[model samples]
Target chain A: MTREHLRILLPVLSLAVLLAAVFYLQPRAMSYFGLNLLFNLAIPVALATIAQMMIIMVNDIDLSIGTFVSFCACVTATLVQDAPLLGYAVLLAAVLVYAGIGAVIHLRGLPAIVVTLGTSFVWGGLAILVLPSPGGASPDWLQSLMKSKPPLVPMAIIAATLIGVLTHLLIKRSSIGVVLQGVGGNERALERAGWSIVRLKALAYGLAGLFGVLAGMALVGLTTSADANIALRYTLLSIAGVILGGGEFTGGRVSPIGAVLGALTLTLAASFLSFLRLSPDWQIGAQGAILILVLAIRLLVTRREAN
Target chain B: MSHITTTTPNRAAGLRDLVQKPWIWAYLAAAAAFGATMVISGGQGAGSLFYAALTFAAFSAIVGVGQMFVITLGPGNVDLSIPASMTLAATLALKFMDSNPSLILPGLMVAIGVGMGCGLFNFALILLLRIPPIIATLSSSFLFQSLAIWSNRGIRVKPPEPLAEFTTGGAVFLPNVALVAILIALAAWVVLERAIVGRWILSIGQNLRAAQLSGVPVNLVRFGVYVASAVLAGVTGFLLASFSGGANLNMGTEYMLMSIAVVVIGGSSIAGGNSNVPGIWGAALFMFLIVSMLNSYGLGAGVRLILTGLIIVTVVAFASKKGYAA
Candidate 1:
């Protein structure tokens, strides 16, 4: 296979392998009801991964995405239900904050990792302030909307597919996408071509914020409640998803479809272990092992291609 | 006219330069934090508070020093495995000691050995596997944490009396742990400032290609730094377990963030090629003081969290911009 084809095939192959392994071990998991159960939690994770992909595309990382999503969930649960106007305003401001973060990082030439890590605490604290405890009911409409059952495919699968296609088109098939990718590939070259790097980065961060909010709202809709720390684990999960999806740290390379598939793979892996009656404590380690194994394979493939 | 222009500008510039030094900001912030603590506590309990803060700062500094070693390796180098290593060390030490006073030394050795093993794993992943340090360390942390959990099995053991004494006991007015921390910092200073190895590390951080061309063993030094960082983290974990009187699962989690924060606040460039061993102590103290002050004022966890985040971002943003090009 050509290198380009191999690059795309890796994530697809990995996902297929995982799915096959899980289905082989537990044949019942292939049923429609079983598939729905398995993929229910994958939606928010996939959305968060897409959000992270946007930031990583700009050669930046957002450590605050998890907490920012949680903050949005808090708003959705409390403010959006009681006072829709204020809730929408706060959520929009959160997106603006992300854009501002991008601007600061670019203008000041600060490291994105540390800046986002710092902002994570700010976002987490704000979430806590908004909802001190873990008991805020999501709006009834949101709950019902997320619960909609389609004919054949599960709602989660449909939503995830839509997200994948929409983002893929926006990022891989559009003119502005070229400029965004250019910002990561060679910032100096892009600047020489008279593009404002700051604006591009800010735009990327804004998109990340928008997706983060969606992920949060989707999570609340599924869970039917919100907590400040609800999506805290999504930070690492999304980073892993992006990497598993064939995204590199320094390059603008990312695939929305691959990310969604990666998210599903990870989610299934966790549930598969649980299905095998493995202890919860070991599940985290098992997940890490899976991530390392996949990355190791990818690394070998890339190294061979280079040679 | 020339003399007047030169003198006026030179004086102003000198003042600006002094104020611009990152260490000065750390100390100023430390002073401000302490003053606030004193004011809130009505100065009656300031002495005890200061001592307590010193003890806490000493622990943080020990961990921070290790983190600084890795950060000095250059941009994109970090050890997320410190917390895991620490937790593992605590568990191993407690289990080895088994509440027996005679086994303390052996337990300490075991802790150090575990740390060395962790360092080796990290080095292997980064060098042999060619994985990025961030993800490599992060994944290793998972392995370590799992190991810790598996071994701990919800068991908690009290440290031996002498080891506990080493952490809590003091001479005249200084706690033993704080003294140990100061000595560690002093040793670090000598190694980084007065040793040949220090120069090699600095050169490597400044420019890897130039350092390699100049006959510096870049890989070896980087390996050594990771090992040293792991060992130091292990030592800190051992002492912290003794100080806290037992070992717990989440004992080392806070160190992960605090260690990085202390390194940055110490005026060390996060991009690497700089060493500020002494500054780490001040920064550690400064961070501890700020947290303590917030706690003393009865601030909520949310507020404290926000302030901590703001402080770290502000310090790193300002400090990294100086004496270096972004």
Candidate 2:
């Protein structure tokens, strides 16, 4: 690989190896859990990571994705009972509503971070309106289907791989992708070039919405019941993954393909923490320490390069 | 740019501004709900709205004002650790009391000191390390939370019985705690408006590089702003502890989003340069009332989050729009 390519792929390779090791050590567990760690906890986490990484790449942030996930989950869980078809419809509708909101905010030329946060509140509010006490139930068969994990290769993992591949294509070869990278690099220069900055931003938000939707879907499956707090941590974890993994690991310009490895690595780390049997307090402390260490290292590396 | 119109904002302009802005409508809506809440909660009087406004106003205003400092003075920078700092300071102060088991007046010193220390901690990380304030504060916040959680271990500490007299069920016109918060607001107004240091803050916020060139002690001002904000948050926490009857680790996290929302919706630009303490105060009352309304509706956590997110988006989006326009 070229040097630039190596910078991107190295992290990816390391994470992939980590995942392999995790699987090897817990092969029985993976199998016992239907051969898909994605269905376990990583799926939602990975999806949230992708959502966050996309926005971070564009040098914007979203504090609302977590709530968005909760909002959609709550709605789906509530609607899923009694009318299975309508529940699916509600799920789709929620996704569209969130996406539409993202698009409007992007088009308005406001900072994505704050706007998304506000929209998150609205969506979360709507979620409360539907099911105030987390009483909704998922269809019994939907849980069975979700938990089944598709014998051939664990469908959720397959789906994630597909997303990673598509993301790879978009970042590497797409026209808007170039525009997005350009905007993040320098907003003024890009705007001066008459590049329709608004459209590009709207598209970025749409990608964020997609990732959030995927995360919500998987999180709903994992919990067997949707609640408001389900994916709240995902917002922080996603951004942390992006920064720690290699997206911001390279000032937010590393390859999208690498992000998958980054996501896997992060999931592995969390699983590792669990494996190590840390208490909840320690887990939180561990997360803080890990972020600080990674950031400190990244800053050191950047300074050395500057030197 | 100019003390957010210090001489009592043009009532006509302010009213005009309110009508034109959706957030004001939101504020009014929140007030209407507060009105309904007062009537339903068995507070039978015209003064109930005013009382409810005062009750919610001070804490939210204090935090909102703190948020204003971080964003405006620091240039769209956020101190995510405000809540953490507030909790740490509040908890530490109360913990100190628990140690000495002080019976009188020690609470004030302990609480304020803890807040200053927390603020000073935030100031050092952001200024000396030159880390982005948001990231630094966020990590510090988590660190603070871990420490708080570890220390508290779900334990709660309450004020001694005598101190409770100053806070709960004692006054109809004004709670003593509310008076303390008002004094804080007055002090902040002086520090951020009339003082030369205040001018330096606004100037730096208006243009950091220029301020640096002008011998404004850039690091000092930057650090001071965060310290100031921390002090405000710390005081808020201490009072909240008293009002709620104690201090706990989880209390401050509740303030983070709502506080930021109150500040942004109050019309301060995220990129900084809007000074209107009264606006911040008014905005806080409205936001608290709004949340209380939502709660009264028996809204679930999901709904609360979504609504908060939505409010944040609309308010900040509008601020950016006005900012760019101006």
Candidate 3:
């Protein structure tokens, strides 16, 4: 198959395989595990994964992503269902937190991994300071959307698809986005080309921050309340998704759409493992194994290309 | 201004010039403050400063060694798998030894093997598949973390007698761990600085292209440094297990961030060239003091972790940006 054909086919085939596996073996989950619920939970995670993939495409990182999302979720949890208007402030604050992280990385020349890790701690600190527990109610509107049932498909899937499609379009067209790919391809070369590395990086992280805000907004609907560590796992999972979607550090490519599919595959894989009722310890092992396999496959393909 | 020169002899001279440059002192002072806060935080007690400094230096030195190797490889590379390697090594040691005296060396060997295995995994990816060093290490860490948790299944196991400390009816006030850490650091210093292998490793980090042209055995030396780093982390992991006397799944997560912090805060540049044994020792002292001071102050886990994160960023902010191309 051509690269494009395989790219499109992989996600669809994955979904099909997952469906077949679930239907064939997990007949109980089919009845108990509603597709609607899965979509609601998975969409935010999938969106956050895309957010992660975007920054990684530029060869920089957003280690604060997971914590930032949780901070936003805490905001939505505390005020969204209470004051309602305060939700805007929380969302704005979360977005700014990521933007601030970007600015810090730019200004200090500190490794993004270190700088964002600090901000992640700061964000987590703020979250714990605000809501020490997980017991807030979302506004009825938010819950209603999350709990919505569509005639044809779940709104959650629709929302995720819309995000994926829009991102695919935006990244392909924007000059800033083009510049980001160029920088990731060769940072020194890009700097020599008269492009502002600082501005380009800021834009890359800014977009990631926006993704955090979006995931936070979606999450406000998912669980109807925010827990402090809700976004913590996404930090690793997002990177896993990006890599699975064929993203590399010395980057020339990232299939954003493929990233979405990879994320979906990852999420589905987790669900599949949970359904099997194997101990959760196995999940860590499984994740590691899958990543190694994917990376190895990529290595083989690149070797073939070189030959 | 001096004209640009590109000879090996000239480069060595430039390195000597850098050693004497005022930036060296300034850099050392800034690095000292990062550790000093920990010592000063102890409120001037007689032995508190000593204890704080030793602990601070130990952790810093262990982590600094790990970071220094990656930097010595030069390029924008450093290990993120240090925590995973440490945890896996400790967990395996604790689980298998289970307070048995004779099993200590065997356990330590196993732990070192695991560490080396992780490093070899990383080296293979870097050399064979040509993955960026960061990506390679990051991916390998996941494998390491999984193996760590899977190895003991999150159980708290006791260290063998040889590895345990006085607190656990083992040694005197010093603890066997302190000795072990020192020995590892000393041995590493010898292997990485004075040995022929060390020179080859330094060459690879200084300029990979030139090193390759000069037939410095680039891949083998680069691979060996990472392997050595993993073994060092493994020994540290063993000490931590013995000191704490309990092995938990997240046992080494703190070290993951701490080790890098030590290397960066210490004088070792991540852009690889010459090793920074003394700087790593100093950094270990600095980190241990800070953590002990915070512990004395009754800070919670969340606050302690945040403090660590903050210190790391602050350290990076102060350190010279002589990474890559330097």
Among these predicted structures, which one has the highest TM-score?
1
Model 2 per-residue lDDT tens digits across residues B1-326: 11322435457786576555433533554556667666666665546556666776777778877877778774537777778877876677666666233643677677777778777767766665555677667766777777777666666777766666666643777756667667777777787778988788888888888888999997887777787787788878777777777788778866777677676676666667555455566567667666666676677665665665555566566656776776
- lDDT by residue (A120-217, candidate 3, tens digit) is 76777777765678867676777787777767776866777887798888775677667778867887899999988777777777778788777876
- Give the lowest summed-lDDT range of ten residues in model 1 chain B: B1-10
TM-score preference between candidates 2 and 3, better one: 3
- Cand. 2 TM to true fold: 0.83
TM-score of chain A of each: 0.96, 0.79, 0.87
Q: Mind giving the per-residue lDDT tens digits that candidate 1 earns over B1-326?
A: 00111334558777675566566667777878999988987887877877887799988999899998898888778898899999999899998998899998899898899999989998988898787787788778878888888889998999998888888878766788888899999888888989999899888889989999999999999999999999998988999999999888899977877888788777888778986786788788888898888898899988987887888789778777874552
DockQ of each two-chain model = 0.58, 0.44, 0.45
lDDT of 1 at A249: 75
Residues A84-179, candidate 1, lDDT per residue (tens digit)? 899889999988988889988999988787788788888888889989999788888888878888889888889988998999889888988878
- Tens digit per residue, CA lDDT, model 2, A132-172: 77656765665675677565677667766876788777876
TM-score to native of every candidate shown: 0.94, 0.83, 0.84
Q: Which ten residues in a row have the lowest lDDT in candidate 2 chain A?
A: A243-252
* Deviation in Å, model 3, residue B168 alpha carbon: 6.7
Is candidate 1 or 3 superior in lDDT?
A: 1
Retained true contacts (fraction), each candidate: 0.44, 0.60, 0.35
TM-score, chain B only, every model?
Answer: 0.92, 0.82, 0.78
